[model samples]
Target: MVVVVGKEEVVVVNFGNSKAVLCRGGLAVPLSSDLKGERADEKGRCDDEAVVGRTINWNACHLPPLSTTSRSLGGEYRKQYIIMEPEVTVMKRTEQSDDFLIIATNSLWNVVGDKTACEVVKRYCVNGESGRLMSSDGSSTAAAASEAATALAVLAMAKGSRHNISIIVVQLK
Candidate 1:
């Protein structure tokens, strides 16, 4: 997952199972689409007839041994189906509505929906709880982000995700 945070906007670029979500107006807004063969757009990108028709066994593409990602930065097997290109999304920063940003792997996303993840972060970040982020100090905010990330990872594990969970929480407001 790649996220570029500018002074006025934030750009998200992603491939494979990772995602970038923005919390706006107390709601979760997805910034990048998971590059899975199950998605119509992703499936249409592949020219292979077999991969296009079949469900790739596990998640989304051919080569179950390598990965289920339809799009990846590097992978030799089934190069025709697994493209290297990534999808990009750009959004203007709205201080009034935007709250925070969440970037996580499939391990977390497989069991947790975007809204649920956002709610979890909000619950900790806004309530002066372990993830309390609404502070003027930078260090406190950093601590909150860490706490929020840990909470998300724990929640994903509790929900029964077998994959490796990685999460990053960025407080915007």
Candidate 2:
């Protein structure tokens, strides 16, 4: 889910059980919302011992297992619950000099902290432009960041594990 407020707009891409939201207002207005029912099952209580072992993490988190949702739009899961792990980008656009960009993915967010993400964006910003004066097309930022994250993920996958990804880009101008 991606929301852009004010005169400016934003672009978002959501993959799998993950979501990205872009908003202009400081108030928490979600541009996109994805709630997966499977979260509840992981919160529920199960009886079978074998099932219990598999569902233990759900109990720890006070959520049910995510296997309840059977079908997904991209055929990523069968009978699996949908989880909305959201990536939110809030850009406060102003007349003086306000431009910003955000790109995110589960893997990137998981490995690289928010500070690192901010630093990456800062590094990409043009030298002369004010920090706030960023690109208007949030999509381009998202695309660039996603590409970087995807490259990283591919390298990680080559090492062994795979990761799901999503990105959000914002410009404050």
Candidate 3:
């Protein structure tokens, strides 16, 4: 994860299934791509039909169930099964655009899509939730970040994610 608050733009680099997005106003400008690991490409486009056919053939002869492996960035069997690559993006940052940066693993994304996550982060920003994250006990920034992260995890679990969930919410001005 990388965010440089430059005078002109925001630079972002994300790896694997985790993502980093720039939310401007109520919209989102995604900075990373989800790597499902199994497929030859992300976005599930048919342009890669030829590639998909060959992958399926290879998997049939080697691994089965190519549906889930379409895009992943995990480590296990990455060389043989999935693609673990990172997506880097750069964008201009303005008062009206590039509001927040959302960096989290698939654990949170698998449960809630971009829109939902952006909304949650937006609310936190608008309501001064970051300031409240530390609470009255003189907790540190880590504590506040942890509190928001646990909230996201709990939400994901409630949304029916079977995997372990973790999140980091950064309130950027």
Q: Which 10 consecutive positions of candidate 3 have the poorest summed lDDT?
A: 55-64
- Stretches of candidate 2 off by over 4 Å are 8-92, 95-97, 130-161
- Best-fitting candidate, measured by TM-score? 1
Steric clash pairs (candidate 3): 35-71, 35-72, 36-71, 36-72, 37-71, 37-72, 37-82, 38-69, 39-69, 39-70
Runs with alpha carbons beyond 4 Å of true place in candidate 1: 45-47, 50-55, 59-66, 127-139
TM-score against truth, every candidate: 0.83, 0.43, 0.63
Worst 10 residues of 1 by lDDT: 128-137
Q: lDDT tens string, model 3, 1-173?
A: 55565768777666555777667766877777665543344534312434444334442222224434443444564444434444667877775445556778777887788888776655444345332334225555445555556666777888987564657765555
lDDT of 1 at 116: 96
Please provide, for model 2 over 35-54, each residue's C-alpha lDDT reduced to its tens digit, 9 standing for 90 to 100: 33333432342323343323
Question: After superposition on all CA atoms, how large is the RMSD of candidate 3?
Answer: 5.5
Q: State the TM-score for model 1.
A: 0.83
Q: Model 2 TM-score?
A: 0.43
Q: Residue-pair clashes per candidate, as listed?
A: 0, 22, 10
Report the lDDT of model 3 for residue 1: 50
Top model by lDDT, which number? 1
Candidate 2 residue 128 Cα shift, in angstroms, is 1.3
Assess candidate 1 and give its lDDT. Answer: 0.78
